[model samples]
Target: MTADLGARRASICPEPPFNALFNIRMPFIYPTSQLSLERKTPVVSTANVGQLAVDLIIASLSLQRVAILESGYCVPVVGAREDGQKGITTALELYGHPGVDFVVIQQRSPVLKVGAYSLVCLDARSALRLQSRKEEFIKALLNFIKDSKFGAVLFLSGVDLSNRTDSQMTTPTYQIRPENSPTLAGTALQRLSSLPIPKYTSPVSQEAQPAESSSSTPFIPGGGITRRILSSLPSEWSVPTASILQFVLEGDNRADAGLLASVVVKILGKEVPQWRQPGSWRDGLFGTPHDQTLFG
Candidate 1:
């Protein structure tokens, strides 16, 4: 059978726009790649694809125009703890270089949410019957990263089988709450890992009870300027874990966003120079991070 390019069309992924999510300004770095490092194809776990997406966006952008229709769903990892869910995002934004496009966030309500990525949402506050101030602050920071014209994101709500379809894409995805992903909530990225959507039945947890929250504690702290400008986030959005990457690629839809991201990485790795690792650099001259090849 012959391949059909014209007959095939890309899915119209409608995620959030950039700049809408960020409440503060942060620095970002966008490096241009000279060598492609794909001596072998890159395989990722859908369960942890959140991290893969970050790597892909950073690497691909350095080489060429990069776009991801991230439809990886997720479960919860961390939330607004009583320790005062304030300023954590502030600590993170200081790290990124100022050159991104969007931090798209798409979801299908309680169906599925990204458990790995760090973010703020109304759920965090409401989980304790409090206003979602902290979640809003995180959202603001996310918008800043996306609006920089650097990159974009497509956050999808809901899960597979349960929702019946992969992406209903109700709300738009934005970078208001995007952060250094694959937070402690997610597992580390490895060549060998599980994919998203378990092939077998996962052990069901017993009935759970949530911790109590204090209402007096504003969803955020007493930062007058920060609090004044940012609005509370709605309970609709969520950040997912990075592990979903591998699963989406190998899931029911072989050609969904997860597979597309993998294919994109493979394609870019083929032509780009950075994908190929350069020889070890001068030992002390630069003290730069070396590329740790996974498998040959």
Candidate 2:
């Protein structure tokens, strides 16, 4: 399953989203009625074809087009919602670093009040099902990417990957880290703190940092191989929660998975310790912790 280490993704490289100096509009998302609410729900509705919903998810990945992240990165989060705001925040904090170029989009105010950039709002799930236009879905997605300035995108959501047909465009794992190169693997490990990791815990994944650190999770190295994780625990740690993140695909066991989240939440980092398999994680440094929440 592993390939090489020297490969580079023209999409995600050492540069930021707006690499060029000037106020160049990297891309644009054409609005569509298809993005609006359906006819079925007229009376008790405050949503659409998941328009703002999708936008919020996209923003969560892009950093609102600033220095923390690039413009092209994206992800779908069927699991995300105004309630999942903290997790979304954790993901953004985890991924974006002075080192990371990813962003986090969250609905800060009520729909009737404050507004946010790089983000769109939508109604709840039931109202949303009224419009499942896959074509419109992929079109808006494609158009958004073509118009944006960034290179790659990660379309996420609770949506199933195997069931969908047109959602073919995406960044492959090999791009994150060439399947073969140990050195490159080493670099990614160090840069892990660069992206968002979401704060909630699991028996398995997502980035883990303390509840406070989740406010701005950063990827870092150290920790250890899946089997050796117990050895890497900070000497004075009072709390620890283990989980398996959805994005990590090396098919790692709970050990690596746990540490991965610990890093996102606790800022625990070091070299990419040995792992049960490749793609488990990339390595980097564990920076200081930030203020955040704690969950059981």
Put down candidate 2 lDDT per residue, 1-296, tens digits, no spaces: 12222232322233322423232443323221122211111000011211222232233323122211111223322233232333222111112223333222222121211111121122211111122222222333334333343222222111122322233224111112211112312221333335454332122222453422332222212111111121222344222212222223222233433333233322223222332321112221123454466432
- lDDT score, residue 190, model 2? 36
Which ranges of candidate 1 are over 4 A from the true structure?
A: 1-47, 56-129, 142-260, 263-296
- What TM-score do all the candidates reach, one by one? 0.24, 0.21
Highest TM-score scorer? 1
In terms of lDDT, model 1 sits at 0.26
Compared with the true structure, what per-residue lDDT tens digits does model 1 show for residues 1-296?
12343223111222222432343333332223322221211222222233334333334444221222122222323222112434211111111122322222211112132222223334223111222433443454344333433222222211222312234232111111223322323211221122223221111121231221221111111112121122222233232222121223223331243333443334223233433211211231146666777443
lDDT of 2: 0.25
Q: What is the lDDT of residue 256 in candidate 1?
A: 43
List residue ranges in candidate 2 displaced over 4 A: 1-100, 104-132, 158-296
TM match of model 1 to true structure: 0.24
**Local distance difference test scores for all models:** 0.26, 0.25
